[model samples]
Target: MIMPRKGGKEAHDEMHKANPNLKVIFMSGYTADAIHESFGLIARVPFLSKPFGPSSLARKVREVLDTQ
Candidate 1:
């Protein structure tokens, strides 16, 4: 059981304000649709569902890194 001091979007927003070029890949146990509805985030944001293996993570990182 893990506890977070701040929400992922809040932390990301703060970091993004400091660095506009920062790329993010959100990882959560919840589904993408659920996250979008709850967080009010756009569909363009990258996301990774939980239980992903190294390969999937690597691919997602590469994809985000390659995005404009």
Candidate 2:
């Protein structure tokens, strides 16, 4: 579980500080737009909305990996 005081982005930031090449696919049960606005994430950032199936998960992973 993530710390209540620190969200995923904060945790990712800390991790990224250690390894700048880290790639992430943020996930949330909230709607993608809501998550993006609330989290201050860019539209093109890799994200996976909840309740996704295997194929969708695979596709998202591939998309993130394929991105520069």
Candidate 1: tens digits of C-alpha lDDT, residues 1-68: 11378888888889999999999998899998998878887999999989899999999999999889
How good is model 2 by TM-score?
0.84
Q: Following a full C-alpha superposition, what root-mean-square deviation does model 2 have from the true structure? A: 1.9
Worst 10 residues of 2 by lDDT: 1-10
- Give the TM-scores of the predictions, in the order they appear: 0.91, 0.84
Hey, what RMSD does candidate 1 come out at?
2.1
C-alpha root-mean-square deviation, each candidate: 2.1, 1.9
Instruction: List the global CA lDDT of all models.
Output: 0.88, 0.83
Deviation of model 2 at 34, angstroms = 0.9
Candidate 2 C-alpha lDDT tens digits along 1-68: 14679887788779989998888888888887987888787898788888899999999999988877
Q: Please list all clashing residue pairs in model 1, or write none if there are none.
A: none
